[model samples]
Target: MPFFTVIIPLYNKEKYISNAIKSILNQTFTDFEVLIVNDCSTDNSIKIATEFESEKIRIIHHEKNKGLAATRNTGIKNAKANYVAFLDADDLWKPHFLEKIFNLIQNFSEARIFGTNYEEIWDETVKMPHNNSDSLPKDFVGYLNFFKINIKQGIYNHGSVCIHKEVFEKAGYYNENIQLSQDLDFNIRANYHFKLAYDASVQMSYFMQTDNQLTRSSIVNKTIPNYDAYEEWAKSNPDLKKYIDFERYVLGKRLKKNNDSRWKDMIAPIEAKNLNWKQNVLLKLPSSALNLVDKIKLLLLKVGVKPSTY
Candidate 1:
């Protein structure tokens, strides 16, 4: 049984950390080490983690709060296993998570990274039969370059990902410069050299809450898939250039980044609650008196305020 390093990059997620750690401990395949990177959490998350007192559990704390990407990089550096896996503090994986993935990787050792389906839990809703299938759509490689289908269609989730340690080292660690879309950039960078795979058997749960998570304010901050990173990935993807429409999309994002005009260039994910116009205006919304206008607009819109299209 190959050992796996389960890395969790945490930041003040006291309310959720115990549950996240417990989920991994409960896994059917227990041959794993849990590395919790504490990015200067103000909450009692560190205390709770320390109380575990398990040799298998290691905690690395930063004096100052570094963001998610940097924290994960820290965990990666500390990892001591052939395989590296990641779990966000807010998500949960099934008991068979590691067992199933291990079997798949044992069969397909050539694949550098693998991802599985996740049950997206939000607003009292649970999307079941989450794991779709293993085969990437025949044209998936094209989408892999710049996310025309995979990201937009929710074909995979990052929470259920596992990759080789050497792959992480060879491809370079996650981009610390990226605030919002570091995952996208890292995956794109990894894809350049690694053979990616999807296993529908492994299951995880993504609890979508209206808290400090990246999804909540992605549009306002443009971080989920950072427009800047998006532009960089799009322009550099040779495969995307082959498809005329995708080529245009890549060029558009590239232009947006070049001008630093993400306000006009980046489009929020369709599933995001924040509307296009709202995100556009709120990006530049000042924290002082200027926010009152946006607050009022949000309130009025919720109360059925509408006007003819300008």
Candidate 2:
């Protein structure tokens, strides 16, 4: 029987670690190992995982409070199977998630990295899949097609993705420096050499527990810009330039953070695509005139306008 090596990096997840561990232990695919790296958590997460002690469960202890990326790296270093998967301490895997991916692994035979759909739950509500997380190709090679669109299909839920051990040998480990977007950065780097398998069956029930009314707002403040995690990865992988128009985009973002020369440096590579409608007189009509134009465009689109096509 084939097996997967699942790595769960636990911090202060005393509140949710038990459920996350139990969900993995209950997987329909039985041949696997679960390695829990207790990242110097200040809470009872270690006790919670220890409660699920079995021959299949192993724990790696990080004596200091290293951030998520380092803790996850510990798990990767200790992984003992031919394949690896990750689940965060605050999430629960749908029982069949692994079985689905493992089946696809056998069928595709050539797949190196693969991911499944998951539900993002917050305050008992499930957020719809990303506005751009759509266009889920039903077969292997989905990611190759996705790369053409550039930074769009970031479907690899850290909790629901699995990769052959060879993936790391090829793409390397997650950048420990990036505070956020580490997984996103890792996936983009991985796709440089690996083919991704898409199967909607890999579902995990996720919960966002933060002290905020809207989770999106909390993420932007707490994680999004803590460090330019994705930026470092993109800089290293120049191939991503087509998909992430990062340099030109800095112009539209918080203008106060951007300086003129930095903005020009970004626009230099793709100056051909820099068509500024904001500076054009015809494009900047009165508000009422613009509203009327928008309405007419909608009416024409009611007839037809090409979709970017998911």
Candidate 3:
């Protein structure tokens, strides 16, 4: 049996599907199968995906359109390997991505989740996220304090992480109710139950400028994760509570700018100590002021100056 089952959730990503498939094909560690779960693409995505024929690649077609979370759940159910790795149809992995993750599995057998650092690509610019890996040793391979490290910038992306199948059995499958932040909901549960093996090596590229990107959509239309579900547990776990508070602060900012009443509920449970002085001040600002701040932030970003999201 293959050591890993690489699951690529596909929709209408025809322009980048070839590169995504090619990256998997070029992996140095070849004992893996590729499953492309197609969620009823209207474009030539399926056609392009089928052009590269190989025994290791299998394309599963859904009869109708389901969202990203459901598409991923389909891949998990169909996966044949004990370890499942997810790569979006628009992302690309380095040749050694699987090799490094395989090494992590051998070294940290107790960990159910394994991840590597990745670079974010936005048009011609490539930037590393502000993760908590700076103090770690080079080529670090060890279990991570998932919530603690994730409080600043997330160390793992959907494309850079590999999960043991048992994680799904215990922590549960991806939440299909929400179209967005499903990964966050699943990660909170998984990290709470299992240790995450992390290799502090950049082994993947997440393309942020892909066509049909769901993240580009407005915040009001999407169903955000129910942070209240973990409220009881977070009360005792400081790291998890702080992590959730940061998320609340970020989402609350967007909701406040949109003048959505849901913003109040989002930030109601957050502890004041968890938020910084700037975050507290910003929360009280009117929607028009928040909109002006957003425009200024965007302008700064264009000039290569990145203001902190907090």
Candidate 4:
């Protein structure tokens, strides 16, 4: 059997599917199978993915469109390898992705979850700068208990991770109920039971600002559900309880960009001491003023200023 089962949830990513599959096929570490789970795409995605002729490639087509969460679960169920890695159809990985993951597994044999740092592609021409100095110690290898890693550096993206199949047995699979932030929810749940092993080197790419992508959709529609997901996770996890107030504080700022009043109640539980002077000032602004700031931030991004620390 292959050492790793790489799962790609395909939808309408025909333009990028070939590159995504090519990235994996070119991996320095070749002992892996590429599983493409097509979610009933109405586009050329299936045809494009099928054209890639490789003995290591397997395609699973869904009879009906079952969103990302269910599609991922299906991939997990069909995974034959001990380790499972996820790749979004639009993202690309450096050639060393599997090599580094294999190295991490060998070094941290006891850890079940492993991830690599990633860069973000903002648009056609812009790319996020890679800075590894801010990551955990370079020489250190092992588990950073989920709570600490999450509190310090946010959870690793699924596209940049590889998890032992048994990890899902202990923590459970992605929640199919939520439409947004399912990735965050799954990571939080997994972290609750196991520490995530991380490789500081950058290896994966996140393509943002694409049309119809879940993240860049209507802010109000997406942001509200993400906050609700955070709440649901916080209810069962006391370790995450301490971060809820702070999470709410951040979520509130995001919601204000859409002139959303929902953040007002969300921020109530946060202590005044938790926020800094700037945060306090921003929180006091009217919705109109906050949205103006949001517009300015978007304008800056459009003008080629990198506002995000990828």
Candidate 5:
């Protein structure tokens, strides 16, 4: 059996699929299989994936279009290895990604989930390191305080994570019903049940410029995770409560900006003490004003100033 099963959930990413596949094929550690789960791509994505001649590659086609969560679940169900690593069709891994992950697995056998740091590519040129990198302890490599470290921004991107197959059995599969924040939902559940072995070395690239990227989509049409489901459990867990509140703050901003009636319910559970004066002020801003703020934030991003709600 392969040591790892790299699952790339595909849709219509024909332009970047070849690079994504090549990144995996060039991994320094070759004891892995690649599964490309195509979610009924009308584009030439499937054909492009098949053109790869490696015996390690396999493509699984869905009869109809399924969203990202379901596509990922399909990959998990079909995976043959003991460990599963997810790389979105548009993301690229460094050649030594699997090698470092293998080392993490050997060193932290008790951790069911493992992840490495990654950089985000903007405009296909500007590479931005995750905000959490500066806060990480020097030479950090071990079990992480998942909630504590991820409060500002998640330390690991989807492409940088490797999970033991058994984690799905214990924490549950990705929530198919959630169209947005499904990863955060799954990670919350997984962190609640198991320790996450993390390497603070950047081993992957998450291209933010890709077309149809979920983060760039409008939140009005999507279903945000029902964080209320974990409300009861988070009551006693301060770290988890803070983490969920931060997420609520983020989603609430979108809800408010869209003038969605659900905004009230989204932020209602959050304690005022958890939010700072700036967040409170932003929450009260009218939709037009919030939109202006978003534009300003984008301008700042373009100028290389990374702004955050915190």
Candidate 6:
């Protein structure tokens, strides 16, 4: 069996699919199979993926257009290798991405989850901010501490993560109900059941496409169920409720940016004593005032200034 089953979820990423597949083919570690889960793309994404002549590549088409969560779950169920790695069709991986992850597994043999650092590719001109650790840490022990570490510094990108297949049997597959932050949901479940390790070197490329991206459309359409999903998960795990409340504050900012009034109801201003000064103040503002705040923030962004957060 192959050492890792690389699962690439494809939608309408025709422009970037070739490079994504090529990156996998060029990996320094070669004991792997590429499982391309095409979620009924209407574009040439499928054509580009199938053009790869490598025997390691295989394509599976969804009869209907399933969302990201279902597409990922499909790939996990069909993965043949002992470990599964996720790489979005628009993302790229360094030649040693898999090799480094394999080394981490060998170093921390007791760990079930492993991932590497990643860099975001915005455009040809601007450089994306770097927020990764200088070096990889030893295994992270518990879910609560690990979640806090993620809030302070990102734990890992989905593209850079490699999970042992057994974890899925215990933690269950990705929730198919959520439209956005599905990867975070899966990681929360997996981390709760398994120990985690990471390789700090940047090894994955996260493309920040200006258009044709899910985040772009999801923002306007109100489909991201980030708050609800996390709140549901937090119900059974009381210790993690604080983290879910934290998500509420972050989501409030996002909804305010979109001029979305849904943010008002989603946040409980009375029970939000845990929030910082700025967050609490924002939550107290009326919906109309929130839009004005969004406009001011946008003006600040254009002038290269951002509101300070606590």
TM agreement with the true structure for every prediction:
0.69, 0.71, 0.93, 0.84, 0.95, 0.81
Root-mean-square deviation of Cα positions for candidate 2 versus the true structure, in angstroms: 7.8
Clash-forming residue pairs, model 5: none
Model 1 per-residue lDDT tens digits across residues 1-310: 3389999988887888889999999999989999999999888988888877478988998888879889998988888888889998878899988886787677776787876656766432434433232345422221133243342324556678888887887888887776765776676667667776666543788875323221233234344344343444446663432222222233333334334455344433222222234433434443343334434534443444421110
Clashing pairs in 3: none
* Ten-residue region with minimum lDDT total, candidate 3: 208-217
Cα deviation at 32, candidate 3, in Å, is: 0.5
User: Which one is best on TM-score?
Assistant: 5
Q: Lowest summed-lDDT stretch of 10 residues in model 6?
A: 135-144
Compose the digit string of candidate 6's lDDT tens values, residues 1-310: 7899999999999988999999999999999999999999999999888888466888889999988889988999999998999999988999999999888888888789987767766543233544543333433322224455564336577888899988999998887876666776677778767878776677888765323322354355545555454556666765356655666676666666566776676565324655657777876676577656656644554454444343
Positional deviation of residue 252's Cα in model 3 after best superposition, in angstroms: 1.5
lDDT tens digits, residue span 1-310, model 5: 8999999999999999999999999999999999999999999988999998467888898999989999999999999999999999889999999999999999998999999999888768778777783668747898898987887778997889998978899989999988888999999999888999998988999887423332465678688899899988798888899889889988888888877888899989898777778987888888789877777666666666767766
Q: What overall lDDT, based on C-alpha atoms, would model 6 receive against the true structure?
A: 0.73
Native-to-model Cα distance after best TM-score fit, residue 276 in candidate 3, in Å:
2.5
lDDT of 2 by residue, 17-125 (tens): 8988889889998899999998888878898889887889989898888889898888888888888999998888998988888877887776798777666564444
lDDT of each: 0.63, 0.64, 0.86, 0.76, 0.87, 0.73
Q: Which ranges in model 2 have alpha carbons more than 4 Å from their true place?
A: 130-144, 149-153, 209-239, 246-310
Error of 1 at 265 (Å): 4.9
Model 5 alpha-carbon miss at residue 179, Å: 0.9
Residue range 93-185, candidate 3, lDDT tens digits: 999999999999999989999999988775537363534446666667798899887866678889999999999999999999886678889
Per-residue C-alpha lDDT of model 4 across residues 32-63, encoded as one tens digit per residue:
99899999999999999998857789999999
Question: lDDT (0-100) at residue 50 of candidate 6?
Answer: 86
Residue 202, model 1, lDDT: 36
Candidate 2 weakest ten by summed lDDT: 251-260
RMSD of each: 8.1, 7.8, 2.3, 3.6, 2.0, 4.2
How accurate locally is residue 11 in candidate 2, as Cα lDDT from 0 to 100?
Answer: 86
